[model samples]
Target: MYHVVLGVDEDEQRAESAAREIANLPGGSDEKRVTLIHVFQDNPSGASATQVASVRDAEEVLKAAGVDVSISEASGDPADAILELAEEDDADLVVVGGRKRSPAGKALFGSVTQTVILNAGRPVMVTGVPTEA
Candidate 1:
């Protein structure tokens, strides 16, 4: 079976995009499984991964497409958590969402997507918010 680790943040658009990508993979969903993960850097209220809006939206899209879905949660650094989960799951691919940022902005704020792409030993798919026509 093909496995994928989909790392989602608070951005619902990006999460849906990544989910759609997985749903549209060449092979049918019968052999595909997705682990939807969300990492919280600081959670004062202690939210679960299943409680994440982005994760819920992605899950609906994936399930409607007949893909198997699972949820995982972690605390601390987002990139590190995502990578760890991907490794543990032996994921065939890691998917993440990215926002368009200026070089200076990215330098100042840092990018979890960039870090994951650079560090992931396996394939990483980065999805961005869709542009309006």
Candidate 2:
């Protein structure tokens, strides 16, 4: 079975886009297992990954598409947590959502997506928010 680590942030659109991409993979749902993960940088309230709206939405999309899904939560640096989870799961692929950022902006704020792409030992797929016509 193909295993994918899907790292979802707070953005619903980006999460859904990534879920849709996984759902449409050529091998079909039965051959794939998706681990939906959300890393909270700060959570004084102690929230679970499934409580995150984007995570829930992505789970719904994946389930509707007949994909097997599991939710995971971690508290720490997002990129670090995601990469750790991928390694632990022995994921076939790591998928993340990225926002459009200018070079200067990305340089100033750093990018988890960029870090994952550069550091991941496994293949990484970056999905972006769709643009409206």
RMSD per candidate (Å) reads: 1.9, 1.7
Clashing pairs in 1: none
- In the range 24-46, model 1's lDDT, one tens digit per residue, is 98799998999999999889998
- Candidate 2: regions farther than 4 A off: 106-110
For model 1, state the Cα shift of residue 69 in Å.
0.2
Clashing pairs in 2: none
lDDT values, one for every candidate: 0.90, 0.91
lDDT of 1 at 132: 95
Clash count, predicted structure 2: 0
TM-score of each: 0.93, 0.94
